[model samples]
Target chain A: MLEHVVNGLVLGGTYALVAMGLTIQYGIARIMNLSFGDTIIAACFATYVLFSVFAINPILALLIVGPTGYVFNLLIYRFIMKPLVARAPDEGALEVDSILVTFGLLFVIQGVLLVMFGGGYTSYSFLNSPVSMLGTVVAGNRLVALVLSLTFGAVLVGVLYRTRWGMILRAVATAPQSAPLFGIDTNRAARTAFAVGGALAATGGGVVSMFQTFTATAGVVFTMKALIVVILGGKGSVPGAIVAGLLLGLVETFVAAYIDPGLTLAAVYTVFLVLLLVRPNGLFGKA
Target chain B: MTMKTSHAFLLAAAVLALLAAAPLLIPDYWTGVLLGMTGYVTLATAWAMFSGPTRYVSLATVAFFGVGAYTVAVLNETLPYPLVLLCAGGIGMVMALIVGFSTLRLAGVYFVIFTFGLAELVRQTVSWWEVNITYTMGRYVFLPFEGRHIYWQLLALAAATFLISWGIGRSRIGLALKALGDDETVAAHAGVDVTRIKLLLFVISSTIITLVGAIQAPRWTYIEPSIVFNPTVSFMTLIMALLGGAMRLWGPLVGAIPLFLLFEWLSVSFPDHFSIILGLLFILIVFVMPEGVLAKIETLRKGSPK
Candidate 1:
């Protein structure tokens, strides 16, 4: 049980990272950003290519890929998101159009990746070391992922709470109409959020590559998990995403260990469904 | 009736006639492809009928399709084909009702996510149980069928789908669904019984999709969790429905034939790049013609004012 708990926490940390990225985009930009998964996959592939061709250490590759993800996301926002947001005259219509456009991006990215890389699983060994935790042997890669995730989360929380840019972002998220009056460039804020969100997602993907074999199509499953985390945590709620991510990780780990591995997704989704039914606003979300 | 409306009907009739006679003109492989396209049409139409007009996006269509496919596959081992097909559809309707009741309360993107999560849950459960139970059962049970039979089965299913869509298009429920799509809160306040109407449409649409799957499983001569429960199917169907003009009764059938043909062509020409092309097409359709090719044509026609 303790082992499961530890495992769950570690996994939850990874989920929290992904969820944080999703929360930023969903909260500030108000776009579903379905292509979030594509960024993750791209980061994974970038890491893979770096390792395969140059024999670069996975840790260094992650550092490089993470920033690439940020730039890619900025491009997506400028090319795809900015146009959609500008065109949509109302909130409801905006939501629909955003879903369609982001979903379109998801498809295009996944398809291009599949063509370029073929549907084959690839993985990288990062740690080559193992650590004992709670009377169980745990991977050093997972430990690295957990530490990085927590650090990233703390930095994000700090940035959101302490920084002027973060305050501007919050202002935009809360009241878009007032932001312009304050001379805040709302478009720049959105672009920054998208880039940061992408970086975080790529970092998560980099961590994932160290632990699991991945293919071009793996993004779909990752996207589903991120979606579940976001829903469970409450859309646009950062702290809520963190809490939900950890809880989901725990649930998935325990389910996989004791019940059945295949049912892990079912278990997570069941909890999400129940949560949506009972508290649509999420556990920590403001009504 | 207006001459314009009559012309549309005439065009539809001609298309139906062509579909009915397609097997005679096409090669055997092409005939099979057309049959597969018909199945996609049925699934796409059913999805559009419920979600498109009601403005409720469901990622669970593939789950319903899988349920129908599995039901038919399991039942056919012991029962007649027609009976299996009916039961498959019934199973799909029951599942849809349960899912709809549970998730329809959430609004907008919440509904989309919940439905998607539910579909994932179904998929995981199916994957877990499929191998063990099906393998054990395979020892004692089996079904016999040929490819050509699938053509007729799919054709009949397509006709039934068209009739259902036509019926819904002309029904009070259809009008209410449209209203709900336009504005859910207003429709609810106007005594639409929004939940009940949505649930009813969900059941009907899911059932039709399952019926299509029931026929399709035997036609393919195999069924698997991943293939039947693929989210790509749901996504592609959404694209097709949108591309043909959502809320248009015959849009899916019109959209799917050409889309499937394009898919086939792409797969043949560049197998690895097929998904890339399809994805690009999806993006193009949304960006360039959000209302769809047919809707664009209709708008132009209206602007011309004959």
Candidate 2:
């Protein structure tokens, strides 16, 4: 049980990092990037390829992955999102169109990755030996992921809270039209927030590369999880994402450990159903 | 009926008659593919019938399709195919009504998630059900009909679905659905029975979709939970409908045939990476022709500076 919880925390922390990126985009853009996972998965595959071929340091993989994610989202915003925004005159239409566009985006990314990576699973192992942690045996790479994720979470939260750019982002998220009136370039801020979302995707990809073997389809599953986390945590709240992320991590791990591991997604769906019925606004989402 | 409605009816009947007879004229290989293509057309048309009018991006077609497939797998041996198909469709209706009522009251996004969750939920339940009870993980079905017989059966189903869709597109409920899709609040204020219409459409669409799956299951010979509940199947139907023109009566067939041909060609050309080509195509469709190809052509005909 202790081991499961410890492992779950690390998993949750990584998911939280991913969810925070989604949260920022949703906060500002009010659109969920379902293809967000594509970037993360790309980062994973790119890191694995780089390590295998270039003989690069595994620990420094994020340096490559992070910028790739950033550029990927920038492309998305430029090519896909901007056209969608131009076409949609209303929020309802925007919501539906964006969802469909992202859904298509999801498949496109999955297909491209499948072409690049095939169906084979690739993984990176940092320290294969198990480390004893508070009487629970855990893998060292998992521990590294946990530590890195927690640090990333702190730095992310800090950046959002303490930075001028973060404040500008918040203002634009709250009031896109009025932000420009207040001398804030809402479009630039929104684009920057998307880049931040991409960085989170890269961090998530690195975490997965460090701890688990992944295929092209692996990131699709994360999109579902991260979307659920964002919704359950509240759309725009980083703190809410962390709380919900940890909660979901515990929920998934404990359920998978105690029950059949295959039913983890079913359990998450059940949680989503309950959340929709009980609290659509989410735990920390503003009205 | 108006001239336009009558014209649509005649066109549908002609297409149905031709399809109903063409199995003999075409080669078995092409016949088999066309039969399967009709199955997708049925799924896509019915899906668009429900979703396009409501503007609800439903992900529950997988749930209904899987349920229909599995229901037939477990019960088809004891029951006649027709009765089994009915039961399967009835089950789909029940599931749709349950899910639709519970989730449709919320926002549109919630509906999307609920449908998505329902698909995953149904898939898991089917897997668990097979593991615990079925003992036979892969159910080998003894379908009484041969390929051509099955082809005709699927054709009838496809035609029936198209006819129903045509009728609904002209009906008062269809108008209400289209209105609701544009703006729910306004539709409600305009005295549209938004919930009831949406629910009814949900049931109608699920029934046709489920029947298609149940009917198509026999063609594959072996039924498994994983194959039956695959989300890709649903995505293809959804994408086809969107690619052709979700609101147009000809959308499903127009989209299904060409895309199926394209998919076959791609599979043969680059079997391993067809998914990539498909994904790129889907993205291209969304970007270049959001209203679908038919819409694009119509615009070209009317709006182009010739």
Candidate 3:
């Protein structure tokens, strides 16, 4: 039971980290990025290449890959997504256009990854030593992943709640139309939020790569998990994501350990369905 | 009905009849390709029937389709073919009612994701059952179906889908659905029974989609949860319908044929790059013609310099 709890925390930490990226993009940028998981997978592969081929530590790789993700996402916002935003007649239209466009982006990124990495799973030895904790053993890599994710999550929360930049973002997210009245550049906030989300995704990927096996095509599964976490936690609530992500990880781990491993996906769906029925706007979502 | 509408229907009937006789005239290889085309035409048309008017993009086409196929696979040996088909439709209807009633209340992105999750749930459940209870992951479908027989059935399904779509387009429910799509709040205020209309169309659309899978299942000699409940089916169906201009009656047909042909060629010529190109095409379509090729053409014709 203790082992499962530790495993769940590690898994959930990564989930929370990735979902934070997704929630930021959706809430602030108002772009439901279907390609977000593929971006994460790209970061994983980049870290893999750095560690395996170049003999660089995955932790060190984060410094390179995270900023790369930010820059890449910034370019995507400027070139691909900006056009759709400009032409959209309203929020509804923007949402629809963004979904379709990012869906296409999902395929594009997946296809490129498939070409580069082949359709096979890849993992590398990082800090795989076993560490004892609470009379149970966990992998050193996973402990590091958990720590990295928790630290990042803390920094993100601190930035969002304690900083002026964070206030501007929150204001835009709270009221896009009214933010401009308060002298906020809604466009810049959106772009920055989107890029920060990308950086989080890359950071999450680097953390996950330290402990987890991943494939180029496995991006969709992560995308689905993050999406579920975001919805469960309430769309834009940071604390909600952390709590829900940990809870989901526990549920999945317990299900796999005690019940049937195959039922984990079913259990997730059951929770999602029941939650949606009970609270359509999510736990922390505004009506 | 107006004279123009009646005339259009008559012309459609004529074309479908000619296409029905196509297997006899064409080579075996071409018959196979046409079979694929007719199948997609049926699926895409059924997808657009509800999504076009309601703007609720359902990614559960494969969930219904897979249930229909699985129904036939499990019952074909014991039941007559027609009985199995009927069972498939019955199962499809129940599934649609359950899914539609449960998830249709959520709007926009929530609806889309919920439907997707529901489909994934169904797929995973079926997979678990097959693995643990049946001790088998796949089943062979031993039906006495020649390619031509499946082709003709698909053609018939395509024709029926088109007719039903056309009929619904002129019906009162269609206008209500259109209103709901435009703005659900206003539609409800205007006294449209929003839930009932959406549910009715959803059932009709899903049942037909289910039948498409049942009719086409025999073509695949082996059936499994992953094979039948592939998410790509849902995405492809949505893309095809949208590419053809879902709102237009003939839009799906126009989009299905050329895109089908392009996919066939792409898969054969650039097998490794197939997905890459498919992705690029999706981006291109959304960028250049978000309203679809048919709408783009219409705009160009009207906007031509005098």
Candidate 4:
């Protein structure tokens, strides 16, 4: 039971990281950044290539991929999101448009990956190593991943609360019309949010790939799981996502271990529905 | 004669004529593609009936389609074909009503997410059931139908879709849906029973989709959880609705047929990157023509006064 609990915490850490990225983007940008999953997939592939070609250490590969993801997010915002942002605020709901556009981007990325990498699953050897944790054997890579997720999450909370940019970001998220009056360049703030969000997502993906094999189509599952975490945590609430992710991770782990693996997803979805029914605005969300 | 009524009839007749004759002219492979496209068109039209006027994108349509398929599959093994189709549609309508009642309080993105989460739940349940249960709850049972019967069944479904779309387009409820889509707050102020209207549209749309799924199952003679609950179906329907022009009577059918043909051609020519190319095309369409091809043509025609 303790082993399962540890495993759940480690898994939850990864989910929390991904969910934080999603929540941040949704909060500040008002765009779901559905392609956030693609960033993770791209980062995984990048890490894989670096490790295979340059014989780089896994930690070093993560450092390279994280920044690459940031740049990629910036590019997406500049090209795809910028033009749409300037349009009439009420012309159409941005959420639907974002879903359509980002889903299209997902398809494009997945297709490209399939063609370049083929459909087979790939894994790194170093990730397979295990470590002893208080007599409970834990995967070494997962341990590293948990630490990184928790550390990054703490840093993000500090940044959001302490920094001036974070203050402007919150202002912009609350009222885009009022933000400009306060001299906040809402566009710039949104771009920065997207960049940070993408980096976090990429970091989580890089860490997760250390423990699991993934293919081109793997992004869909991650995207779905992240969305669930975001909703369960309360939309736009970073702290809520952290708690929700851990809870969900524990639930999924227990379900997968005891019940049928097929039933585990169903159980997670059930919890999501129940949460929505009980608290429509999410656990920590502003109703 | 009212202009809207005349225009709707003309559009319906044109669509009917096209669908009726399409199989005879197209190749066998293309016929199969067309069948799939018809399903998309049917689903898109149903989606539009709810979303076009209300501006709420219900992801639960996929769940309805899945339920409809499963219902037909399960029933056809024991019951008559016609009974199976009716039961499938009835089941879909019930599910839609339940979902609509539950989530109608939420609006905009929240609604979308709610429906999406619900659909995911349905999908997970279906997956679990398929894995654990010994007896098949959602497997396709073949009804003995030949070429002409299949063609006629498709035509009938298309005709029903056209008539229903026309009715919705002409009705006050349809106008309410449109008003809701334009601005929910204003629509409510204008005396529209927002909840009832949304629930009614949701039930109507799901019923049509379930009908389509029911007939489609027998035509394919096989069904599975993945194929029935596929997000691709939702995406394809969405593309068709947007491409043809949402809220327009003939838009879905027009968009679906051509898009399916394009997909078939691309898949045949470049099987390796077909999905990628299709994705790019969708992006290009959004960038260049947000209103859609049909809407663009309409704009051009009006501007030239031809």
Candidates in order have lDDT scores of 0.79, 0.82, 0.87, 0.78
Cα lDDT tens digits, model 2, B1-306, are 256866866886897788788878988998888877888888889999988778888877888888888888888889887898889989998888878877777777778766755666777767876686665687867887777887888888887887788788778977887788778999999998888888888889998888888887887788888788877777788789989988788776789889988877887999877666676777788778878789899999999788
The parts of candidate 4 lying over 4 Å away from their true place are: B1-34, B59-61, B115-121, B135-140, B301-306
Candidate 4 chain B minimal-lDDT segment of 10 residues: B111-120
Clash totals in order = 0, 0, 0, 1
Query: For each candidate, C-alpha RMSD in Å?
Result: 2.6, 2.3, 1.7, 2.8
Residue pairs whose backbone atoms clash in candidate 4: B53-B177
lDDT of 4 by residue, A167-284 (tens): 8877876787899998888889989888888988888888877777888877766777788888888777889999999998999899988887777767776787687679877788
Ranking by lDDT: 3, 2, 1, 4
- Say which prediction, candidate 3 or candidate 4, comes out ahead on TM-score: 3
TM accuracy, model 1: 0.93
DockQ for the candidates, in order: 0.65, 0.51, 0.64, 0.57
- CA lDDT of B93 in candidate 1? 78
lDDT of 1 by residue, A1-287 (tens): 88788879889988889888988888788788777887888888888888888999778887898898888888888888788888887777777777777777777788888877887887877785989876888889888878888888899888988999889888887787889899999888878987888999998888778777898877766777888788777776778788889999999999999988878887877787688778877887767
Binned by DockQ into CAPRI classes (incorrect, acceptable, medium, high), candidate 2 is medium
Residue lDDT tens for model 4, B43-150: 888787777667676666677777887777777769878788788878888888777776786756666765655555677687677667855544657788755455
lDDT of 3 at B40: 88
B1-306, model 3: which lDDT tens digit per residue? 256866876887898888888889999999999998988888899989888878777778999989989888888889999999999999999988977776787776876776765666787898899899989888888899999999999888888888888788778877887788889999999999998888898999999999999998998889988889876677778789889998888898899999899888988999888777877788778889888889999899999997
lDDT tens string, model 1, B14-72? 97788778777878887788777877888888888887787676767777777777777
Native-to-model Cα distance after best TM-score fit, residue B182 in candidate 2, in Å: 2.4
The better-scoring model by TM-score among 2 and 4 is 2
